[model samples]
Target: MVVNTGKTFDPQRMLGTMRLADVDRGTDASGNHLIRIAGKPVRWALGCNFDVWPWACPATASSDAVRFGGDIAQLTDPTDTSIGMYVGTNAYYNGIFFEEQPDGSHALTTDIAAPHYYADGSTVITGSIRFRVSYDLMRTDMGIPNPETLTSTSLAGAVKTPTGAPAAGKFVTWHDPDGGGFFIEASGFTFSRKRLLVDAARITPTRPALARTVRKTARRGVLVHTRALPRGARVTSYAAYCRSASGHVVRASGAPGSSVVVVTGLRRGRSYRLQGGRELQGRPRCVERAAHPARPSLTLRPRAVPAARPAPASRGRPRGWRSTPHGRCATPTPCGWRTRSRDSRMVLNDSSA
Candidate 1:
C-alpha cells in the first residue's frame, strides 16, 4: 500500500512505479447535460509516495502525478533499500466496494487480511495484516491513508476433483472469501442472473446425467432459482441439463457454478437438471452441493415478446411528417433521448409526456 505524508519526494530517490484508477464521487443523473460531479483525482494528486518510496507534490511533480522514481540500491542510511509502490495485491479483493459515511464522504473498504511476504527475505509476519484506504472529494490531506494492523488469520487448503477425472487444470488456487474459491467467485457483486453454466447441445460429453437439447430457438432468456445459504457462501460454478417434451435432451454449463444457463438454440420445451450446487469460497474445497441425489431440480424458460403491430399510413400529409397535438409536425427519428422547451417552440416527445 502507498501513503503520502503531505510531503514531496526527490525524483532521484524514486525506484519503481505504481498505478491506480481515478477517484470518482458520482454523476448528476438528471441535468441539461451529463455533469461529472466531484470528479476523479490522480492516485497521489493531493500528496505523493508509492509503497515505501517518497513522492513529489503536484506543484513540483508532473501533472496529476502518482508514482515515484528513485534508485533503490542506495539508501540514506546505507542499510535499508528499495522504495515506491502505491498499490497492494496480496489480499484478494472480494469485490469492488465503496460507501458513503455520515460526514457525506465516500469510503472504499474491504475485509481481506493479507500477510506481508518479502522475496528479499527481509521480513515475514505470521500474524494478520489489514488494509484500509480512504478517499474524500473534500479532504485536502494525504488522500490514501496508511494500512493498520488488526486481528488476522492464516489461510491454506487443497482441492482434488476426483480419482478418475479432474474439474479444472489451473493450480488449486485458494482465493480468500473475496478472491473467489479456487476457481469460482462466490462473493462480491452478484447480478440478478448468472452466465450460462450448463452446456446447451444435443450431445453431452462430460457427464451422462446432464441432458441435451433436441431443437433450437431464436431468442434466449434467463432462468433463475434461489435457495437459503450461509453468510459469505456464494455460487462459484454450476451445471444445467434440459430436455424437450418428447424426451429430447439439451444441456448448458460454463466456468464452474454459473447461476444462469442459455436455454436457447432448442425448441420450446424446458431444461431440467436433477441437481446443481454452488461452489463456496474460502480455503481449497470441493463442492458437493450439485452432486446430491435428493436435491431439487431447476427449470428455466425464456419469455419472448410478440411482434409489434404495423403503424397506419400517414393521414394525407408529408411522407415523413405526422400531425401533433399542437400546430407542429412530428417525425419518428431515433436521435436524442431528451426533451426540452424553447421560448416559443417545444419538441413533442412520446416518452416524456
Candidate 2:
C-alpha cells in the first residue's frame, strides 16, 4: 500500500518549535523520507536570502522551501544571507543590493549589475534641475534730463534812458549775436548814453600854471656879500627884504649900504629872490672897501703868542733845577721851558735881545 503525502505547509506554524540546529536535518513530519541537502544549512540559507524575484520558483513547493518567497534567489556564494529589492518612487531604481552573510551581517552584492532604470541621486529635492540661473535689472524711467536749450531771441534788447541816470541794481538781459546769453549789470540807459553820462560826471584834472618868473637887480647901497646871496649879483633898494634860508622874509627900509647881511643869521644852502624885477636891472655898480683888507695876509704869519708854555722855576734856581725832594724833575720839559707852581704865569723872555 502507498501512503499519499499531500499536506499544505504553513510558514508561520511549520517551524514552530524547531531550533536552527534541527533545521539542518532535512526531515518531513513523518520522518520516513530524507531530503537532499545541496549545501550546509546556514550557508544555504544565507546565500538564498539575497533579492532575486526574477530568478527561481518551484511548483508545489512546501512553505519551508518558499517561505522566504519567490522574491529571493540563491547566491552562488554561501556567505550572502540578507536580501534587498528596489522600491523607489518616481524614476529612481536600485543601483545596489544588500545581502546578509553567514556571519549574520549585511553587505552589498557587488556582483549583480545595476538595473537600467537606476540613476545617480539628485543633489536637490526639486524634480527639475538647471545648471545656472541669470537675471538682469535695468532702470527704464529715471535718468538725467537734457539741458534746457537756449536761443538768442530769448534775451531782451539793449536798455534805453531818456533823462536821469539809470537806477542802481536795475538789470537787463542781452543776447550775444553768436547765440550766447548774458545779463547786463546796468539798465535804463543805452550803451552810448551810459558812456557819455559817465564821462560828463567824472572828475577832470586841471593843468598846472607856470611858476612866477623871477628877476634880480642891483641898487645903490653898501652891498655885503653873504651866504644869503653868496655868489649872485648884489642889489639894494629903499624898501628891501632879506630872504632867510629858512624861507623867512625880513623887511628893512632905509638901511645903509654898508650894513652887512650876516648869512650866518640865515640857514645854510637855501635859495632866495631879490626884489625890483627888471627896473633896477642896469644900475651903476657899487664900490665898497673891505672891512679887514689885511685879514687874509695876516693868516700866513705864525701866531705871535705861544699856544702854551710851561711855568718857570723859582728865583735863584739853576737852569735845569727841579724842586722835587730827590732833586730831579718828575718829567722833562721842552728846551727853553721851565716848571713852577700851579698858580705861576709863563713869561716869554727875549734873551737874545
Candidate 3:
C-alpha cells in the first residue's frame, strides 16, 4: 500500500504510479494490512481473478470475500458482519454428478475504498484465487463530513440573504437550539401583515383648505391641527415636509388618527407643509340628477269656465263682469279669467299668474 507521511500527492499525476504486488494460491489467503503512519491514512486497491477448470471435476465452485478491519486480532477473530465485504462469481452445474458442468471465472478490475476512508487492503480468497494489490496516496480531507460527527449546527450561518426584498414568498431563519440565538437570517424576528390600506378610486384626498390653524410650539416646531374629514374618511397618518435647497425633506411622521400632528426640527425661515394620510371605510353615496324626458316638452291648457252670467244691463254693470264676496271684480277674457283688486282698480285683461 502507498503510505505518505509527508506532503499530499496530486491524484491526476499519481495515476499509474502505484506499487503493485501479485499473489497466486489455491487455498484461503490474506493480502495486506496497514496502520496509520504519521497523520495520513493508508490508500490501497485490490484486483482478483478466480478460475475453476474442467479438470477440477466434481468440485463445486465456492465464493470469495474481502474485508477491512482495525487490527490483526479483529480480522482473525471477527465478531460482527460489519468487518467484511463479500465478493463472488456464479456457475451452473447439472443435478447428476457425472453430467457436464459449466466452468467459473471471476475478475475484479480495481476496488477502491470510499472517500475519506482508509484502505486496509485486507482480504481472504478460496479455491485457486489470484489477486494484485496497488497502493497510492490520497488527501486526508478529500471527502464529505463524517456522518458520526454531524450535528444540528453543522450548516449554521450558511444561508445568505438576498440584496432586495422579494415580491412574494417568505424568508426563513434557522435557530440554534443550544445557544438560543437566531442564525441564517436577521438578528431578531419581525412580524408583519399585509393591509388593504386604501382604494384611491373610492376615496377622496384631504383638502388643504379644511386644515385648522397651525399652532407654533416652543421646540422650534408646529402642531398641525386638522378639521373633521369627509364622511367615511379618516386620517391614518401624518407627515411634515419642507422644501430645501436640494429637495423636499420630510421632518417627521405622526401617529394614526391623530388630529394634531407634531412636526419638529424645522428651519425658521423655510415653509413647511403638513400632510395627512387618509383611508376610507366606504365611499359616500352620491345623489344623481333627475333624468330628462326623451320626447317633447309638455304644455298645460286652462279649463274653460262657464262665462259669468252677464251682468244685467239695467244694473249698469259691464257685460261678463261680476262681483264676489271680497268685492273683487271678475270678468271672462278670451285667454282665461281676469280679476281686479279694489286697491288698484286696475283691469286684468291678460292671462298671467
Candidate 4:
C-alpha cells in the first residue's frame, strides 16, 4: 500500500515529509502527481522503494531457489514514468533540491527491463513500486518576497514582537557607514554606540579642567576632581599623572565617572603638577610645628676702682688668679679685693692671698 505523509507534517519542526507517488503497473496504477494547495512552488527530494512478490524467479522452483545474477534486468528509457522491479531494492536521489513545475506539480519516472514478467503461480511475479518524494514547505523551499514592497515608519513596526512592543532595555540596531552597528537604547542611560556620527564632528570637546582638594590623611595626600563628561559620551575610568615625572610618572586612577581621585605619599613642602582631565598644581603644608617663646641672660660689669698690686714675681701668681692689664682682678681675686656691682658694692677675700 502507498501512503502520502506530506498532508500532516509540521512545517516549523519537520524538514519535509515523504509521499508515495505511484506504481508502474499491476493492481496499483496511481501516477506521480503532486497537487498544490497554495500558489507556492515545492523543492523536493525523490526516492523509490520496490517490493517483489513470489521470491522464486521460475514458478516451478521453490521460494529458496537461488536466483542468478541479472535475472531482473535494469530499467531503460529516459522518458519512462514507471518503476519496475523483479527483486526488492531501494533507490534515492540523495538530498538535492529540484523545484516544482510552474503549475505547482512534480513527477519522476524510472526505467525497468522487461517491465511485465509473469510466472505460473497463484501470485503474480510483477513488482509493486512506491515512489516517495520529500519536499519542504518551509525554510529553503520557500522564497522571500521582494524587499521593496515592505514599508514601515519604525523598526518596531516592521519587525513586530510577540508582546506588540519591545521589552525594557531592548533596542533597535542598525549598521553605520563607518563600521560597527549602533542602537537606540530604551532606558535613559547614556549609550556610546547610539551617538550620531554627525554629532561627533559638530560637538567640540572643551579643554579639560581639574579641581583639587587637600586630604588630611596620615600621609600627605591630595584629591583631584574631574569634570563631568559631555552628553552621550562614555568613559570607563580616569587617571591622574604628574607632569614633571615623564620617565617614571606616578599614576592614580578613580572609578568611572567619579568626581574625585585620591593621591597620597606627597612631600611636605614640595609642589606637584596633577594632570587628570587637566594639569593643576598642588602643595602639602604642616601648620602644627610653628608656635613657642624665648629666654633671658644676665651680664655683670666692674665699676672703676684702684688697681690692685700684682703679687711679687718671685712668688709667682697665685694659682687660679689672673691680673688684668687695667689692674682688675679676675675670678680668684686676692684677699681684700673689692669691686662695685651693678646693684650694690661687693667685696671678696681669698685666704691664700
Candidate 5:
C-alpha cells in the first residue's frame, strides 16, 4: 500500500510489486544491523557491502517496516531518536544552517566569524564582514587668506613738494606714486610725492625785462636806478663787484619784479663804470673827476671797449643732447636754433655820426 506523507513521491514501476520477502534482508546474529544512509542513488540495507556500520540499520530499511506516507520521509537519528533528519542533497543544506546573535543579529556559515552559541541556548555570530559591490573615498585640504586684509605699506617714508610756487596753468608736480625723485625735467622743478628730495632754493621765476637791467647795475657796485620799476615792484637789494674793463666777471642779486640787493663794501671816488638794463637806461662809462685838489680827480672814461671775438664753429653736440629755445641745454634733448644764420645775421651802423 502507498502511504501519503504530504511530500512528492514517485515509485519505480518495476519495484512497486516488490515485497519485504522479495528484498534481501540480513541482521547481526547478536543484535540489529548497522546501516548508514545518505542522499546517494543506490539504496543500502543493513549488513550490505556499502553499509558503514553493520550493527545499526537505517530507520527507512525495509526490514524495519518503515513506510513513507508521501514524497517526504522523516527519520530518527540512530544515536538520538529525539532529533529528526531529512534526506536531501547539497541544494537542500546550502541555505539551511545559520546562527543568530544576542543582539538579534544573524549570520550564515559563509560569514567571516563562526557562529557562536550562548549559555541561554541562543546562537550568535560576531565580527564585521563587508560585501561591497563598489566603494570610493575622497579627501581635500586647502589654504586661503582673507581678501580684505592689507599686508604692507611700501611707500611709508616717501616725500614730495613743489620745486617752487605752483605756476599758473601748470601742475607743479606730476602724478607719480614714487614722486618725481629721479626725473630730470626741463622747465619745472623735480620733487617727490610728499616732499622735495633736493633743495629747491636755487629755483627762481623767469627774469623779467626790468630785473635784467638792475641785475647788471648790482654787479658793478653802483647805485642802480629803480625809479622806472613797476608800481608794485620792491627793491630788495643790489649786489656789486669790480672787474677789468671788457671782462664780464660779476655776480648780481635781486629777483624779477622784486627788491634790489645792494652790496656794502666799496672804495669811494674811484673811477668806475655803470651798466644797467630795463630798470636803468645807460651804457658803462667812467665817473666824473672829483672837485678837491688834494684828492686825485676820479675821472671816469668809457672803459676801453674790447673787440668782439668770433665764436668758433661748434663741433655740434653729441647725438642725444637736447636743444632748447631758451638757450639752455637739457637732457633727452629738445629741438631749437643752434646759431644765427647768415641770412638772419644783423649789423648795426651809426647813422647820425
Candidate 6:
C-alpha cells in the first residue's frame, strides 16, 4: 500500500516485487489475452481509504467498482496521453491526471487495475502504475493543490482555540492525518505525525482536565509549589528543567498542554526553565509555553498583636502610703504628706500640719 504512494514500507521486508509491460502478455492460442501481477500487489477497493503522502499519485476507485464514492477516472490514448511513473497530472500525456476543472482542480481519483473490462465509452486500460490521488477536503486545506514539499515540521493541524476559554466540559480532540481520533483524558497530550489535526468538540457533558498540582519544599521548609494542569495552548507534552545538586539538569514532565503543573523538591537559589509542548495520545511532539517568576513565600504569614489588659488593684498600700494624683504611691515626709507631682515637684500639705 505504501509503495503505491511512492513510499517504502520499512517495517516489513518485501519478499520481492515484479512488473509488467503491455507486450509482457499477448493473445494466447485461444485468442484470449493474459495479464500478470508480480508478488502480492496490494489490492485497491472502492470507498476504502489508504493512508498516503502528499504529491504522490494515490490509488482510488477502480473502474469496475460502481458501488463507490464516485466514478472519476481519466482516459487517454497515444496522442492525448503519455504514460510513465509520475506524481501530478500532466495533460494525461504520461502521468496521472483527470481533465482539469474550471477551478483548476485536476485529479486522478480512480485506480487502474486488472480483472476489469474496458467499457466502450467508460473504462479503458492504462499502464500499470499503482499511484495515489489527493483528497479534496483534507489535502487542499493542507495546501497541496499543486503538491508542496512535505515534512512533519511543515504540517499544520494544530489550531488555537477560539481566542478564549473552552466552554464548560468542552475540550479539543486530536486526530491523525489518517482520521483516527485521540485525546488526553485529563491533560494536554502530543503525538508525532505530520498532517495531523486538533479540533474542539463540545459534547453534552464536559470533562475535567486531570491535572496534578504539587506543593513541596525542597529548600528550608519552603515549598516551591507547581500545579499540574490539563488545559492550555499547544497539544503536546510539557517539561520543566532545573539544575540538581549533582549539577545535572533534571527534568519533570507534566500532562500534555497542562496549564499549571508544579515541579517540586527544587533546591533554593536554582532557577528552572520550561520547554516542550502539550501531548495527545501519540508520539509526535511540538512546542508551547507557560511561565512565571520565582516566588518562594507560601509558608509564612503575619501574626496578630494582643491588646493590653488592666492592671490589678494595688494591694493595701504600705502603712501610711497613699495614692497621689500621679500614677504613684506617696510617702509621708517629716514636713507632711508629700509626693512628687506630675510637674516633677515635691508638694507638701501644710493644711494637715
Per-residue error for 248 in candidate 5, Å, reads 11
TM-score of each: 0.21, 0.11, 0.18, 0.21, 0.14, 0.22
Native-to-model Cα distance after best TM-score fit, residue 74 in candidate 5, in Å: 99
How many clashes in each structure?
Answer: 38, 7, 0, 2, 40, 36
* Tens digits of per-residue lDDT for model 2, 49-149: 12563322222111221111111122344322221111111111123233343422222211111121112222211110000000000000101011012
List lDDT for all candidates, in order. 0.27, 0.22, 0.26, 0.28, 0.22, 0.27
What TM-score quantifies how close candidate 6 is to the native fold? 0.22
Which regions in candidate 1 have their CA more than 4 angstroms from the true location? 1-219, 227-235, 254-264, 268-275, 279-295, 301-353
- The residue-by-residue lDDT of candidate 1 on 27-80, one tens digit each, is 233322121111122222222233321212122222223333312222354222
Candidate 2 lDDT trough over 10 residues, lowest sum:
129-138
User: Which candidate, 3 or 5, would have the higher TM-score against the true structure?
Assistant: 3
Candidates 3 and 4: which is better by TM-score?
4
Of candidates 4 and 2, the better by lDDT: 4
What is candidate 4's lDDT per residue for 189-253, written digit by digit as tens?
A: 11111111001110111223455445332223455554533321233455555423233334566
CA lDDT, candidate 5, residue 57: 21
TM-score of 4: 0.21
Q: What lDDT tens digits, residue by residue, belong to model 3 across residues 1-353?
A: 33222222211111111121111111112323322211112222222122432213112112322322211112333332212211111111111111111211111112111111112323311111111111110001111112122223322111111222322222222222323122221112111111010011212223322244242421234445454343213434554443344354545555546655565544323344443333322222321122123322221112223444565799887765654544443544244343433433333222322
What C-alpha lDDT does candidate 3 achieve relative to the native structure?
Answer: 0.26
Off by over 4 Å in 6: 1-90, 93-236, 244-248, 268-353
- The true-versus-predicted C-alpha distance at residue 339 of model 5, in Å, is 49
User: Candidate 4 — which residues are off by over 4 angstroms?
Assistant: 1-199, 202-208, 215-220, 243-248, 278-353
Candidate 2: stretches off by over 4 Å: 1-237, 244-246, 253-264, 276-353
